[model samples]
Target: MTASYVAIVLLGAFAGGFVNGLAGFGTGLVALGIWLHVIDPLYGAPLVAICSVAGQLQTLPAIWHAVNIRRLLPMLVGGVLGIPVGILLLGHMAPDLFRLSLGLFLIAFAIFMMFNRSLPAMRWGSKKTEGMVGFCGGILGGLAGLSGPLPTIWVTLKRWEKDERRSVFQMFNLTILACVAISHLAIDGITVAFSQLVLIALPGTFVGAFAGIRLYRRLNDHRYNLLVLIMLAISGITLVVSEIG
Candidate 1:
């Protein structure tokens, strides 16, 4: 690879890793924007999945205490059921339209949440509702590497404490990303070139994740919420611009 290619890959990996560490999700949102400029989407998608899994695993120990199997199971079940369906729809869906619609929704929701300071916590969604959201998230993840946003948005509305919320989406994203990676492997099998890219990305991902985890330790609940909102808004903006540009 050329120097510019190497630099872009490292930059994308580090950015994605840092976001995953700090926010418990969003590695793809942050990384793919950079990587797609140099890498084909097919290769870039799997690379994001691999690096995101790495980043999440690296940061998992920090949030292990907050993981509640009872709370997480519903989402996982729903998400698992939704993945194959998404994979099936992957080729049929119109890419530009899907990205545009999701992007606009994200941007609008983030802006509304940011402005609405006293929004009441949504207390009505039971486990069933959570499961449905997870299913949708799974489909999105499978289809477009976008599994994080829905769950992230849901937990925010649920108004759990920072660690609790982080634990939910972090674990969810980890599971979805791992599934996506496996699906890619089953279908595409990793090229030798892909393996090399993973090797190149590993160091930056680890270092960035570690740094982000350290900073995460310092943020209070309010700041963490704000940070997540900001990340979501950025993700939306990235999607919109990429689709339109």
Candidate 2:
């Protein structure tokens, strides 16, 4: 590969890894925007999936104590069950329009949340509601490799502390991304070239993730909440721009 290609790949990997580390989700959202310029979406998609899981795995242990399996189970179950359905819907849906609509919604929601200082934390959603959110997230993850936004938003609404929020969404995203990676592997076995690209990406991913985790540790709950909202807004903007372009 040319030096420029290598540079671009590493840039994307680091950016993705950093975002994943800080926010607990959003590797694909950040990386794919940069990687798509150098690689086809077919390759770019799986690469992001693999790299995202790696970044999450790298940081998982730090947040392990916050993971509550009973609280997390319903979301995981619903997410897993929704994936096949999302994959099925992918064939029928107009993906661009769907993404556009979702993008607008994310932007609007993020802005509203950012401004509404007096909004009360939502307490009405029990496990069933959480499962439904997870189900939507799975479908999005399956359809668009976007599983984090819905659950992230839900957790934010619940006003869980930063670590609890991070742990839940990070674990949820890790599971969803792992499933995506395996599905891609099943359909398209890893090529030698793919392995090579992964090797190039790992160091950047590790470095960026560590840096992000350090920043994450420093943030208070309120700051982390704002950070997530800002990231979601940026993600929305990215989606809208990509679709329109």
Tens digit of lDDT per residue, candidate 1, span 66-112?
99989899999889888888889989999899999999999999999
lDDT of 2: 0.90
Return the number of clashes found in candidate 1.
0
Candidate 2 lDDT tens digits, 1-245 = 88888888899999999998998888888887788788666788889888899999999988999999999999999999889999999999999999999999899999999999579898798899889999999999999889989998998888889999999899989999899999999999988878878898878888989999999999999999999999899889988988998
Clashes of 2: 0
**Ten consecutive residues with minimal summed lDDT in candidate 1?**
24-33
Error (Å) of candidate 2 at residue 135 is 1.0
lDDT, each prediction: 0.90, 0.90
